[model samples]
Target: MALSDDTMRGVNLGGWLVLERYIKPSLFTVPECFDKGLHDPDVCTNDVDDAYPQDQWTLTGLFKNKDDARKYLKDHWANFVKEDDIIRIKNAGLGYVRIPVGHWIMGDISPDEPYVDGEWGDFVRVVKLCRKHGIQVWVDLHTAPGSQNGFDNSGRTLPTPTGVGWSGNPENVDRTIKAVRDIAEGIKQEGIEDVVTGFGVLNEPFKGQNEAQVKDFDDRAYRAVREVLGEGTTVYIADMFDAERFNGFWDDEEHGNTVLDSHYYHVFAQTPRGFSPRQHIAYVCEKNSRDVNACCWKGGGAGGGTSVGLKRMIGEWSVSFDTLVCTKLDDVMDSYREGGEVLEFTRKIGEKRKKFLRNFAEAQMVAWESQDTGVSVGWFYWNFKMEGGAFAEWDYLRGVEEGWMPTLKAEEKAEHVFGRCEEIIFRTDDEMDIVHEFPPSDSVAPDWQAVEADDDVVVSHGESLLTKGSRERGDGIVLGFLSLVVFLLLGLGIAKKCCVRYFGGAGGKGGYQRVGEVGGVGEVA
Candidate 1:
C-alpha cells in the first residue's frame, strides 16, 4: 500500500491543551488567584531572574505523579477538551487530531504518582471525540519530562541542565521508551484507534551532546513503541539534530513500522521575524517545493535532503504573528486601492501583503505534497493553540474551523474557512498532478479584500514590509549600490592580474622593454 492516506487530509487540531500557558490562566481559571502574585502570600515574586528559573514561565508542575496528573487531566477536561475543539477538527475536514501530551500524563516522567490508572480517560475522551466525528487521532508525546528538548516545549526539563543523551542515564532512557509504549498499550486496550492510524514517539528529539547518543535514544524508542503495538501501529519519530541524524532510518531500513516526522521553519536563512504567519507558511512551502527539484540528491536543496515524502509532509511549521491579521490582511484593513490615498499609503502595504498571502498559502500547499520522503505520517505543527502569546492562532483555527462550526453549531462561517484549506490541498495534492494546475499567473492571484481593516480587528499587516522593495521599482537601491561596488572590486582584480602595467625594474639587472625593441636578436633599447 502507498505510505500515505489521502483521505486524512484537512485542517490540524493543535494548541488546545498545552498552549494555555501552563494549564491554568488567572482570569480563565475558575479558582482564580484574583489577587496579583504581588498581593498573594502564597506566591513569592523573586525579581532575581536566576533565582527563579524560566520554569516560572509556566504554572504547571515540574513533574506530577501519573495518577494525580491523570486526575488533573480528567477534572480539567472541560477546560482543555472544549467542545469547540472537536467541532473545529471535524469541521475543517481534517480526519485526524494529533494531541500532544506532556510526560506528566504518562507515569514514567512523573515517577511518583505516575500516569495514574484513570488519567488515561482524558485522552480516551479525545480519542472518542475523534471517532465520534469520524476523525483519526494521533497521540504525540509533546513534553517529555527531563528535556527531550531542553526548551519549554518539552513540558519538563532536567531539575538541572544536563547535556544530551538523557537516555544514557538508563533510567530516563527506560522511562521515555516506556512512556510511549504504555501510551500505545493504553490506547489499544481502550479499544481506541490511536495506533490504528499513528502515534509519535516524542516531540522533536533534542540537540545534545553526541550523534551516537541521539541514535541510541531513537533506536530504543523504536524498540519500545514496537513492543506494545506490534505491526498494527506506525511509530513516528521526530527528527532530532536535524534530518541527517535520522535520515539513516529510511536508507538503512533498520526501522520498521515507523514514519519519520520532521519540521521546517524559514528562520534558518530568511529574514528573522520578517515573515508574517502567511508569509512564513508561503515561504516554507515555496522554499520546500523550490527545494524539491533538488531533492533528487541531498545537500543540493536548502534543507539538504532528497526524499519525496519528506518534502511533501514537511511536518511542523509556525510563525510569530497575528493569525487573523496575516491571513486577512487587505480585506480587513481597508486598502488604498479601494478608497483614500493616505489610507492607501497607510495601508497600501496591506494591499501588497494580501497578494503575498494568497500566493504564499497556495505555494505552501504546492510544496508540501510535491515529494515523497518515504514518510506519509507523523507530521504536526508546533501547536494548535496558545493561552496568551500569539505565536499562532492554531487553537482558534482548530476551534473555529474544526471545533465550533463543525461540532457546536455547524456554522457556515466554519465551512468557508475549511473550504479554503481544502482548496489549497486540492490545488497541490500530489494525487492531483499540478501539471494541469492553473497557469502560474493565475496560480498566484491577489485578494485585496482580505485585509481591508475592519476596526483593525481582523488584521495587522505587521510593520510595513516595504511595498516598493524591488530594484527596478527602486527597492534595493542600497543593495544595488553594494553590488556595483563588488563588481568594481572584481574588475580591478582582473586588471591587476591580466591588464599588466609594465614598469622599469633595475634596467641593468632586471631590465624590461617592449618586445621587439628590447630583444637583442631584434633591436636593443
Candidate 2:
C-alpha cells in the first residue's frame, strides 16, 4: 500500500455518518419540539433561541430513550448514503472518498454523553460498498470527545462559537487517541486495508487556540495508529489552516507515508468579500496556486529531497464563493437575510453565475493538478451531494448536473479546461501588457521617489530607475559563474561524494525508501 503517484480526485462523504444540520435539515426537525415549543433547558436558555436542535448533541437529547435515539440515527445512516451513491461515485471516476466519523463510532464514550451508542457497523458497511465499487477510503475522525472546533460539524455546537474544550482537557485528548487506535485496529480486523488506505487522526482542531496541544495530539495519535496499521497505511494530519507552518512537520526519518490535509474555502473570509467573478477565478489561479505549490515543495530542488517530499492534498474545499454565506455566525442561515431582502438575489444572476462557477472550478483544478508546481496528491470537494440540492454551489453532484463541475471523464481531457483562467486573465490586448509588467501593481500605480544628493555620494534618477534591471543582471552573472565552478568540480571528480551526500544517494541518510524498505513497514500489498 505505497503512496500512489496518480492524483486523487475525490469527494467527501460528509453529513452521512456525521450529522450536519445544514447538510440534511430534516433530521434536525422535531415536530414536537417545533409544534409544542419544547426545548432543552440546558442548551436553550433564552427565548430568542430556536426550539429545534442545532447539533447532534441537542438533536439526540430530544429523544426520550437511548433505544429511540439509536434507532433514529441508524435509520438515517442506512438511507442517507447507499450502494447506489457509491456506484455513482465510481461512475464519475472518483477513486477516493473521505468519510468523516464521530468519536463515538466505536461505542467507547461515557453513557452520559449525548451521542448515539454506536455507528461502527454502518461505517464498515459503507467501506465494504466502496470496496465493491473499486474506490479507496480515507477515514477521518471528524469529532473529538469534547467539541474540537465548537461547530456542529464537530458533533457539538457550543453556546459561544469559539468556546473550544477538546485540547484544554487532557482526558479528552487521550480519549481521541484511543478512538484513533480503535479505528485503525477495526480496519485491520475487517481485512479492508487494501481499500481503506488512509486515516486522518483529527479534523480541523482550532489552530489559533490549540497549536501546541494539537501538535502533541497529532504526534501521539500518529504513533498510536502506526503501531497498529504500520507505515503501509497513509496517516493524514490537518495543517490546522496553516500549511506554511506545518509543511515539513513530519519529514524526519521516523515518519513515512504522512500527508498534510489543507482545506481551502473562499467564502468564509473577508478578503474575497468584494471580489467580482473574474477576481475570484484570478485569485485561485494566482495566489492560491502559489500557496499550494509552496506547500507541495518540501526541501531543496525538485526530486532532490528525501522520501518524496511530505505529500499534501486539499482535503476539503467547495465551489462556493459567496461572502454572504458566512460560517462565523451562530446560525449560518441567518446571514442569508440582510436589510429585509433575501440574499438569494445574488444567486439569481442566472446563467452568469453558472458560467463563472464553471470557469472557477476549472481554474482550481488546473492550478492544483499542474505538475510544474509540485507533486500534489489530490483534492476532494467538501461534499459529495447535499440533501435536496438546495445549495448547488456546495454540492458536487449538482454542479456536474448544472454544467459547471467537470466529471472524471471530462477531467481526462482537462488540457482544454486548463487554459480557461489564462483566457480570462488575458482576454484583452491591454491585459496581455499587464502580465508582462515587471513589478505588477496592486490596483495602483507604482510610486518613484528621488533621493537627495549628499556631499560624499551622488544620486542619479537614471541609475535609480535601473535598480531592478541591474540586480537581475548581477544575479544572472553569479549563477553562471557558480555553474561553471560546479562543472569543473564534477569533471575532476571532486564533488561526486559531496553531491551524493547532499542529494541522498544509496546507503546515505535521508534517502528515499519504498514501502517495506529498511525504514518502512512490511512489503507493499
Candidate 3:
C-alpha cells in the first residue's frame, strides 16, 4: 500500500509510555539510597550523581534491584504521561504516535524481585486515547526480553552497564516473540486495528553477539507476529542495528505488511573533515536519502516493485544538534548532562544559532520526506516531549511550537518534495514494480578542501587517479592519432592528383612510364 500524506507526520510518545533516564530521570529514583553517599563510589563507575546512579537508572533496574524505589515507581506509571498528553499530540497537528513499550509490561520476567507489576492497563488507556483522537499508533516493542540494546532504555542492562540481554539464548528469543504476539494480538482483539498503524517487533536489538542468530531471531519474531496478526497487519522491524544488511529481509510477500525502521541522528557525527553544522546537515540529507531509498526499493531498479511487499520508514529521528567535536557528548544521556551548557553557548550567539537550528530541523524533515530511497513512508520524531525544555530537539511538540519543524497535516499541499504526492496512488497489481524517489534538495553543497596527504595517491570525490602520468598519456594518444590520420589523408590526396593530371591527359598511356625511361629518350634528343 502507498503512504498517505498524514501518515508521515508523527511524534513518538517517549518517556511517557516508556521510561527513558534522560527523558524522565525522576521516575527512576532510588529514594532509599539517598542516605548512602552520592553515587556510592563503589556502585557507580562514574561517581558524579547529578543524576541517579547508573545502576538504578533504568525501568527494569528500578524494580529488579534493591535501591530502586518500587512503591513510588508504581505510582509514576499512572501519573507521568496522562490523557492530556495524547490530546496535546492531536492538537499539535500530528496524525501518528509511536508508543514504545518494554516486554516486562506483558509479565514480570523476574517474579522473585521485590518489584510489583505495573498496570498494563495504562498502555491500553494510552492506545485507546490516541485512537479516540484519530492518531494512528505504531506500538513499538522498544525493550525486548534481553536488553535488545545494552542501554538503560532497554529496560535492563549489565552490572558493568553493557547490554547482554539477547545472549543467543533460545528462551530470550522465545520470550520476546511471546511479548510481541501479546501486543499485536491484543491490539487486533480490541477491535482498534485501524487506529493501530503498525507493530514494531524490536527496537535497536544489537549487541556484540552472534550476528547470524540475531537475524534469524528477528525474522522468527516477525513471522510469529505475522502468523498471529495475519497477512494484513503492518509489522515493522528495526533493521537490527545495520539497516543496509537487513534492508531486503522482509521483501517476500509472505512477510505480509511490513516496514523497516532505522533511526537517523547526527549527535554521533565525527568531524575530522571540519564540516560546519550546515555542511554536516547537507551531507547527512544527501547520504541518507540515497542509502534509505536504496534500502526501500529493491528490484529492477529504484522504486522497483520486486519489493512492494516491504516498505520503510524512520521509526525514530531527532533534530537535537550536537557533534562529537562540539561537546564531546556521544549519546542523548551524555548530552542531557550538558544541555544547559550547550543552551548557554547557543544563547551567547543570540538568535543566530537558533535560526540556524530551526533551518536545520526543517531541512531534516524535508530530507526524510524527499528521500530518494523507495520513499520513507513516514517518520516519527524521537519524542513529543522531554525534560530538556526548548533546547530539546527530541521533543517534536516543542520544535513545532518553537518554529523548528514544519506542520504538514493542516497544510493545503505537502511542502516537502517527497511529500508532494499527499494523495498516494498505489501501483496496479501488474505495475507494482514501479516506485518513486524524493526530489533532490535545493541546498548549498558541502565545501571540500584538499588536506595534506601522506600516501602517494589521494582519494578525491570518489575516484583515484595518477594525475600527472594519466593526463600526459591521454593527451599523447589523442595528438598521435590525429597526426597519423592527417598524414594518410594528405598522401592519398597527392597520389589521386598525380593520377588525374598525368594518366588522364590526352597523350597519357593507360599504364604509367617511369622517369628513367624518359631520361633514355633525352639522350636521343
Candidate 4:
C-alpha cells in the first residue's frame, strides 16, 4: 500500500531498451527506394547517406523502423538489473522499478505494422527477475503510439506530443488511445499482471494538453484497459502537457486503483537568467519553470490531499552536470559520479548548483513521503541502468561502473542493486542501507565495437559517453511554492532571498539600512 523507497528510485534501460539515442546527421535517408517522406521533421529530411545538421538532432536518436530499434535493444541491451544492483536499489528499502517503454512498440495487435509477439518479452523477463528479487515493475509507456516528444528522443516523428497539426480528430485520438489499450490488454493477458505494479499512461503528455480532451482520452484509455484486463489495474497519467491542467483526475473512482504521476528537473532554478553555456560548452534541459507550471496546480505539492488524491510518482531525476564524458574512451563514468578529473569538468553551474540540486532532489523525495499528495506517491530516478557497453551485439556491463554482469551472478543479487540509498540519499529511511559500485574504467575493452560509422567510431547512442560522456540524465520534480518567487543566491551558494523587492524585503518597507558588510535598499519611509 505504501510505496517504498526502492520503488522511489529506479533506473531506465535507455537507448537499447527501446528508443535509439541519436542518429548520424549524414544518414538522412538510406537505400534507393525507402520512403524518405516518412522522415521526421525533427530529423534532417535528406538523403540517408547525407549528413544532417549535428546540433539539431544530437540529443534525439533517430530510428528507421521499430524492428531496427528492437534489434539493437535485444542484442546490445544486457541485464544491468543485477543482484548486487537490486540489493543496492533496495538499500532504501524501496519496492518498485519504473521501466520506460516506447509506445511505438506494439504487437500485430499493432496497427503501425510489423508488431512482434514478444516486443517487450525480454523486458518482461527482466521484470519477472526483478519481482523474484523483490522489485515491483511500474510500466512507463514513455512515448505514445505516435512520438510524445518529436525531437530525436521520440525515436521518430510525424506524430509527436505536439500533435503535428492534425484536425482535432477525436477519431484519431481514439485510435491512438486504443493502440495503447491493446498493449495494456496484452500485458494483462500475458499472465504477468502481478509483475506489473503500475502503468504510466503517456510520458510528458505536454503538447496538446486540452484539459477536457486529456481527461477524456485518459478516461477512455482506462476503460479500454478494463475492457481487456478487467477492473483493478492501477493507471498512471503524467501532466507535463498544459491540456486538462486540472487536478480533477487521479484514481479511477469507479474502479478505484490508479496513480497520477509527474516528472521534474531543476536546471532552470539552478541556472541564472540570461545564462547560457556561452562561455562553456552548450548544455541544457527541459525548463524547470515550465515544469513548475506543469506540476503545480493549487493542491499539487505538499498537503491538500483532497483536490487531487491520486498517487503521483516523479519517475526520473538527476543533477545534470554540463559534463564531457571520460577521456579514456573506454571506461568513462567509471570515475565520474564521485571522483576523478571528470568532476572538475562538470558544469559551470557551480557549487550553488550542487547545493541547490541536492536540496531540491532530496526535498521532493521527503515531501512525497511525508506530504499527502494523496494524489501521487513514490518515484523512480530518471534512470538507473546506464550500463551501455554491450559488444558483438550482446555484451553489456556488470554495473554502472563495475564489470560484473548480473545475469551470470544471479545467486549474488538481492532486492536492491547498485544501492541508490548509499550512492545518493536525500533522507534515509532508518530501515535500510545503500551502497553503489563504480568501476575504475569505462569498461573492459569489448572484443569489437558496433561502429555505425568507422570514421567517428561512436559507441552507445553514438554518445561516446565513455569519451565526453554526459554526467547527467534528466527526470524528477521538486514541489515547493518558495521556489516560485525567490531567486537562488549564486554568489552566496545557499542563501535564498525574496524576489519582490530584490534589495528591500526583510528591512521595514522602504527602509535603507546597512548591516555589517551587507547593504539594504529599504528605508523606513
For residues 1-525, what per-residue lDDT tens digits would candidate 2 score against the true structure? 667767788899998888886676656665434433554333332233355577888888776666667876787888888898888888777889999999988877677787875677878898999999899999999999877877788888876444258888898888899999988999999998888999999998765566777888999999988899888888888877677676556766577788888887766553343344545554565456556655634453334343343677789888776532323222434433222432232332256566667766776776666555445678888889875433557888767767777765523634344453333322211111111111112332322111111111001101111222323446566545554564466446354333322221122111112212121000100
TM-score against truth, every candidate: 0.57, 0.73, 0.67, 0.54
| lDDT measured at residue 511 in model 2 versus the true structure, 0 to 100 | 18
Q: What are the per-residue Cα lDDT tens digits for candidate 1 across 215-332?
A: 6766777677667766556656666635544543443334444556556544222132233333343234323433333322233343455443232244465332222322222332
**Candidate 4: C-alpha RMSD after superposition:** 15.8
RMSD of each: 18.4, 14.2, 19.8, 15.8
Winner by TM-score: 2
Model 3 scores worst on lDDT over the 10 consecutive residues at 421-430
lDDT of 4 by residue, 1-525 (tens): 323323244544444344432211112222221235444433322444343322212212334454543443344335434466556655534456777665545652345433233446667677767777777777766554344445334434443236432115565565557666867876776777777757766666545445566667777776776676665456767665331254545422463555566554322121211122110011111122123223333344323333323544566544332221212212332323223353222222233332333433433343333232233345555445332321100111222223221221222222123222111111111110111112211232221111111111110111121121111212112212222212233223333322212222212111111123321111100
Q: Tell me how far the alpha carbon of residue 150 in candidate 1 is from the true structure, in angstroms, after superposition.
A: 1.3
Residue 491 displacement in candidate 2 (angstroms): 57
Error of 4 at 127 (Å): 1.2
- lDDT at residue 198 of model 3 (Cα atoms): 76
lDDT per residue for candidate 3 within 340-368, as digits (tens), equals 34222232223444455555555556556
Q: After superposition, how far is residue 57 of candidate 3 from its true place, in Å?
A: 6.6
Off by over 4 Å in 3: 1-7, 35-51, 55-70, 111-116, 158-167, 272-274, 300-306, 323-350, 371-374, 410-525
By TM-score, is 2 or 3 better? Answer: 2
For candidate 4, give the lDDT: 0.39
